[model samples]
Target: PLGMVMGSCVYHIAHQRMGAKIGNIGRNVEIEQFTQALYDARELAMSRMQAEAEALHAEGIVGVQLRQHSHTWGSHTTEFFAIGTAVRPLRDNHIIERPTMVLSLDS
Candidate 1:
C-alpha cells in the first residue's frame, strides 16, 4: 500500500548581533546560531517523517520534500515541514534495467 507521510517542526531562534552592533561591523558575517537552528530543524523533521514511514511498514520513501514556513511567526521563529510518499517493494528481489549504447567505427 502506498501512503503519504508528513512531519512538521517549529523552532524559535534567539536574536544574534547583526550589522553595526556594538563591536561587530562587517560586510557579510556568518551567523552560527541561525545556521545551527535550521540544521537541527531539518534533521528533526526528517527523522519524524522516517518514523511515520516505518509505522506504515514501508521499505522506503520517495519524492521527499522539505519546506520552510514563517506564517506570522515573527523573525526569530520558523517552521519546517517534510512530506513524502512511502512505498513497499513488490518482491524480495528486484532488478533494475540499465541502458547500453554501441559505438560505430565509421565516421
Candidate 2:
C-alpha cells in the first residue's frame, strides 16, 4: 500500500545582539542561536512525519519534500513542513539482489 505522510513545525526567531563594538568599529558575526533554531525546527518536522508513516505501518517513505513558509505569522516566525509518500512492501522478508556487471568486448 502507498500513502501520503506529512508533518510540520513552527518556530520563532529570538532577538540577539547584531554587532560587537571594538574601539570604533563594529563586527558582525553569525548568530549561533538562529542557526540552532532552524536545525531544531527541521528535525522536529521530520520526526513527526516519520511517526505518521510508522502509524500507517509503512516500511519506508520516499520522495520526501521539505519546505519552509511564513504565513500570517510575523517575520520572526517560520513554519517547517515535511511530506513524503509511505510505501509498504508487497511481501514480507523480501530479498533484494544486486545487479551483475556486464563488460563489452568492443570499445
Candidate 3:
C-alpha cells in the first residue's frame, strides 16, 4: 500500500498563502475561502504523509519538513511537500512528547 520511497535531510519551505485573483474566483469571496483552499490542500498532503508513515510502520515522523507552493505564477496547481525521518519509538516507553511550561509569576 505504498509507492516510491523517500529520503532524509530534506530542505524545507512552508507557506500558507493562496491568491485568488478577482474574476478568477468570486471577487466577493471572503478571505477564509482562499485560506480554506490552502488548508484543504495541506490536509490532503498530510493525509498522504500519514499513509506513508503507516505503510512504513513508523511510530512517528521526526525532522518533519514542509514545503508550500503559495505563489501563483499563472499556475493553478499547488501542493505541499513534506519530508522527514520516519521512525518507530521503543515499544515500552513510546510516548516522547515534550512539555513546555512558563514557570513565572509576574505581578
Candidate 4:
C-alpha cells in the first residue's frame, strides 16, 4: 500500500454533576440545565488537551475528534469525548539521537 497513517483513536469521557437529583420521569423539566452542564464539562476536557499540546510545543493536532453522550444504567451521568495527536516540526540534524525535548509517543 501507499504511504498512509494508521492512527489510534482515543476517547475521553467527561462527566458533569447537575447537583440536582434526577426527578422521577421528568427529564423535560431539567433538559436545559443538563445540557449546560454537559457543555461545561466538554470545554474542560478540551482545555486540558490544548494545554498538554502546548507543553510539548506541538505544531498542530491531527485526526482530532470529539463525542458526547449521557451515562446510562448504573453510571447515571453525561460524558464528552475527545481525541487527537500532538505534532511538532521535524528538523533534519546530523545528530543520531534525538534531543531530550523531542516529543515522541513511542518514548
Candidate 5:
C-alpha cells in the first residue's frame, strides 16, 4: 500500500484586531497577528505530517505540498493543509533508475 499522509490546521484572527484593521483604509499596515497565525499554522501542519510518517515507520517523505483554504468561515478564518507520501528503502545497495535527458550533438 502507498504510504500517503496528511495534516491540517485552522486559525482565526482576533475580532478586535480585525475591527482595527477595518478602520484603517488606505494606510499600508502590517498585521503581525495574522502573520504569526500563518507561521504557527504552517509549523503545526508540517509537524503533524512528520508525525504521521513516523507512525508509518517511513524513512522519509516526498512530494510534499502545502495548501491553504478560507472555505465558508469568512476572511478571518483560514485552514492550512500539508500532504506527502512516505517511503522506505527498497533493499540493501539497490540502485533506482531515473529518467534523464541527454543533449544531442546533431542540434
Candidate 6:
C-alpha cells in the first residue's frame, strides 16, 4: 500500500535596497538573497513532507516531486509544494521482486 503526502510553504522575497541605486543601469549580477530564499523555501516544504511521512510510520517516501507556483498573493510572493508517496515494508525481511519485460513482435 502507498500513501500520498504533501507539504507546502509560502515565501516572499524582500526587495533589494541597492536595486533603486542600480536602476536603469545595464549590468548583470547575481541576486544572492533571493536565491537563498528560494532554496530555503524548497527545503522547508520537503522537511514538512518528511515529517508527515514519519508520523504515518512509513519507512520512506518515494517519487518525491517539488513544485513552485505564483498566485495573487503578490508579485514577490511564491509557493513551494512538495509531494511524494509514502511506502512501508509489509514484513521485516520483505524482498522486492524484479520487474519482468515482455517484447511483442508484429510486422
Q: Which candidate leads the pack in lDDT?
A: 6
Name the regions of candidate 5 deviating beyond 4 angstroms. Answer: 16-24, 92-107
lDDT, candidate 5, 1-107, per-residue tens = 24999999988865555668677778887777788888998998989999999999877778889999887857788889999998777886764454367989995
In candidate 2 the C-alpha lDDT for residue 72 amounts to 78
Stretches off by above 4 angstroms in model 3 are: 1-30, 71-73, 91-95, 98-107
The candidate that wins on TM-score is: 6
| lDDT (CA) per prediction | 0.83, 0.82, 0.59, 0.55, 0.82, 0.85
lDDT winner, 1 or 3:
1
Candidate 6 lDDT (Cα, 0 to 1): 0.85
Report residue 7 deviation for candidate 4 (angstroms).
17
Global Cα RMSD, each model: 7.1, 7.1, 8.4, 12.8, 6.2, 6.4
Task: Tell me the tens digit of each residue's lDDT in model 2 across 1-107.
Answer: 47899999999988664453242255466667778888999999999999999999887777789999876757777899999998776777874343367999998
Per-residue lDDT over 1-107 for candidate 1, one digit per residue giving the tens place of the 0 to 100 score: 47999888998877876543544564476678889999998889989999999999987788789999876848788899999998887887963234356999999
lDDT of 4 by residue, 27-100 (tens): 54645555566667777667766666776676555556777665464254656666677766566453333435
**Model 2 lDDT, full chain set:** 0.82
What's each prediction's TM-score? 0.77, 0.74, 0.55, 0.50, 0.74, 0.78
Shift in Å, residue 68, candidate 4: 1.7
Q: After best superposition, candidate 1 residue 30: deviation in angstroms?
A: 0.8
lDDT of 6 at 24: 28
